[model samples]
Target chain A: MEKEKVKLRIYGMTCDDCVSTVTAGLKKQKGVIDVKVSLKDGTGEVNINNKEVKPEELLRNEVFTRPSHYKAIIIND
Target chain B: MSEPEKFDLVIIGRGAAAFSAAIKASELSNGEMTIAMVGTGPIGGTCVNVGCVPSKYLLEASHSVFKPAHPRMPGLHETEVKYDFSKIMEGLRSYVSHARDSKYVKVIENYSNVKLFTGLGSFLDKKTVVITGPDGKEVGKVSGSNILIATGSHPSIPNIKGLSNTGFITSDTIWEMNELPESVAIIGGGAIGLEIGQALLHFGSKVIVIEAMDSILPQTEGEIREALKKELESEGMRFYLRARVSAVSRSGNWKSLDVITHKGNEKITVKEIIVATGRQPNTEYLNLERVDVKTDPRGLIITSDTMKTSASGIYAAGDCVSKNMFLETLAAREGVVAVSNIFGENIKIDYNSTTWAVFTNPQVAGVGMTEREFSKMNGSCSTRTFSLLNLTKASITGETEGLIKIVVDPKDNRIVGMQILAPNATDIITEGAYAVRNGYTIDDVISTSHIFPSFSEGVKLAAQSFIRDISKMACCVE
Candidate 1:
């Protein structure tokens, strides 16, 4: 399985509680091996196995969906 | 009896302003300066005791209890959450007491040089204050080389025919309720009114908010005001704008208010009435006249930028003094600045960077100039707004009901003002305040990386909207 690192821009977090919630939510997603969320820069990075799931699918996971009021969009280099 | 107790400084009030002044003065003097804090009111003052702390706690509590029935998610089934009004009120009281003890009373215990005198203090002359006990007996007298009046303000009641006889409660008295009113008619649609009205409505009380002004939150941005009104209305709260009360009469347990609106004379009946009109300074009790301290027609102490009153060596701060806005933080800051200046350092209170917020459902927060203020300035300014609906975080949280608007100097692209109506608008407005205070341009905000999925990102998005259409840009794109 090929591992890929994806950087995302996150928005709507106001405190450290939001940061932790986001980190836990991303890590729970299928195929996501690791997740790092930053409160300072409002960015997140998720390392995942490309063979198990697509980045788009991970972004669209219920963990990152509505009700939590957090959104993540992959940054294109 | 014992020569008049002397001190380096005497603070007349025990609120945020007085505490801040005492702490700062003590820090500056390194425990050498003797200070006398004389006040008959509750030790912690308005913010912790009656104003912000208790009100916000109740608002948050109501929101939590109401969440089950009004959850924004589509798939979630509605459920009723029952709450004991008395228990909730008790909880609020406990929280206030604990906060006051820890934040104000306990903290003051450490400063040995600061003496706390619990009594009503009136200025006897320029340098003397006569303290009276609860029974109106002169307990003692204190004199200071420098005096800082931070007595704060009290809720103002409007004069209406038969109103006093019919009975009503103000913010100060609302907390004493053990049971929620079946229906409430709130007079005055300002921040306090709207916040309380919405909170009561959430707690299963029918609320009618009557504003004499053409609109609620007259000082807030017009768009934000309308949006908040709509949101609150959707939650079943009623609003009567441009309505004036002529008289009040009670029939049984119901109170009937004779109001004149554009529609004509009408009677509004409610179980209770809460006055959220406004507040007036505590200068009257201070006997400023005796000390020759100048005050405005409304009795607000007039002070210079350095918090110096018209009389030399007499300084004033908090709600007692005229300011662009009344806030606990601002009051505390003013107190610190006044103490700093009293110690021979010159510093002026800067209101331009002072951020204020209304703790409503979708909080209304702003810093710097409003659109109307900027227009009145007659300068080259342009404005841009970004809706929370466009933000993924708002969508995810189901709080996509507000927007962030920024007013900028078109020539230099510097932000002059920023207003936000959102869930965490109060917390996020600091970023905007910093930008406005530092004269940060749109490029500066857009260039600075903001947290992904945070309300603070709304600031950058608002700033980014000035040059490019945020809707068309990809995430994190400058």
Candidate 2:
């Protein structure tokens, strides 16, 4: 299976705790191979198996939905 | 009897400022610095003990109890929730104790170089302090190369006729009561009074808030203040603006307050009275004058940007020192800054981006200048506000009662200030703080993708409203 790296501009992270929360939430998503969230730049990068999961599907997951109060926008690079 | 103990740093008071200083000093010195902390009061200071922690806990409990009857959704039936006031108080005490233990006491135990002394510390000289126990006896003496006075503030009771004689409870003492008052007259409509007033009202108490000024929340924006007042008033909380309590006297089992308002003199009777006027610095016991340390007229210790008192090697932070605002985060930052400067780094405290919140039902928070402040300086600045009524998320949650106001400097389109009055304003204000701190413009905020059906989208909506009519735009339109 092929794997792809997706970079997202995460919003509403105020501290390291928020970064950890986003990292943990992303890692729980389907087909996610690895995740790294940065507080300094307010961005997150995740590697996922492209054959099994789509990047847009992961972007619309409940992890970035209401009640969690965080958002992520994929950056096309 | 023996020689006075000496160390590298001596911190007086055990609140946020003192703990922050000790922790930062320990980190900077790689846990090798010897420090002595003398505190006669509670260990965790105001934030963890009586001020923020307990108050917020009670507020949340009140919110839970009030939610059933005041559910905003249609077809949701009101349900009764019975509560034991004493049990709630017990829970609050336990929570405060747990927080203090985990956040302060246990954390301090790991710093082997730090010593804790439960006593009042007064300056013997520039580098020495005589510790006195609660019994007023001299316990011991400790000397240090540098000293920090983070002794926090206490609630200031007004000098009303017969006030002291009639007796009253303050925010500090009110927590000790097990039974809720049948009716409470909260004096001075500041943040504490308003918050406590609303909480008590929700907990089934008849609450009346009296403010000597024409408006409540004197420091907040006028629109925000009016909006909050209207909301609370609709919920049956009473308010007497521009009122002065001329006298307080007891009548049977009730307390009577003779208030002089704009209309005329009126008498208010309540089962209890809470004085939330303001706070004064805890510098009285520090013997600051004896040590020639300067203090403002209000008894707040005067300090330089580096947190240094008039006496060299003596520094102050937190509510004890003069600053634009008193907050736990700001106090901690000041402590860290002071320690960095002491360790040969040049740093100054900056409050331009300091954010604060009043924990009311619809929390009021602001970062940077208010509309009035901006108008006073520059008349050319543009302002935009979006009501929660138009925000999709607020409507979905049935909490469309607040508004977000953004003030921008049109010259460079940079956001100068932002004020939010919403259910989660406290959590959302930090985004505005970041924008104002980094000089982000309205376009920067609007371009960022906010989660749909989220309170934070209010920021983007307000920013978007500046360029085009938001009502004409689609839900996810840029």
The count of residue-pair clashes in candidate 2 stands at 0
Residue-level lDDT for B188 in candidate 1: 97
lDDT of each: 0.87, 0.87
In model 2, what is the error at residue B137, expressed in angstroms?
Answer: 2.3
The whole-model C-alpha lDDT of candidate 2 against the native structure comes to 0.87
Residue ranges of candidate 1 with Cα displaced over 4 Å:
A1-77
For model 1, residues B1-478, the per-residue Cα lDDT tens digits are 6467977788999999999999988776556567899997789899998899989999999998888998887899898998898999999999999999999999999999999999999998888888999999999999886899999999999999989999999889888989899999999999999888888999999999989999999988888999999999999998889999999999999999999999999999999999999999988778888888999888899999999999877899899998759999999999999987765556899999899999998999999998778878865579998999888788888999999999887778888999999998999998889898899998999899899888888888888788788889887776
Two-chain DockQ for each candidate model: 0.01, 0.01
List the pairs of residues colliding in candidate 2. Answer: none
Per-residue lDDT value at B14 in model 2:
88
Supply fnat for every model shown: 0.00, 0.00
lDDT score, candidate 2, position B8: 76
* Docking quality tier of model 1: incorrect
Error of 2 at A5 (Å): 59
Q: Give the worst 10-residue stretch by lDDT in candidate 2 chain B.
A: B338-347
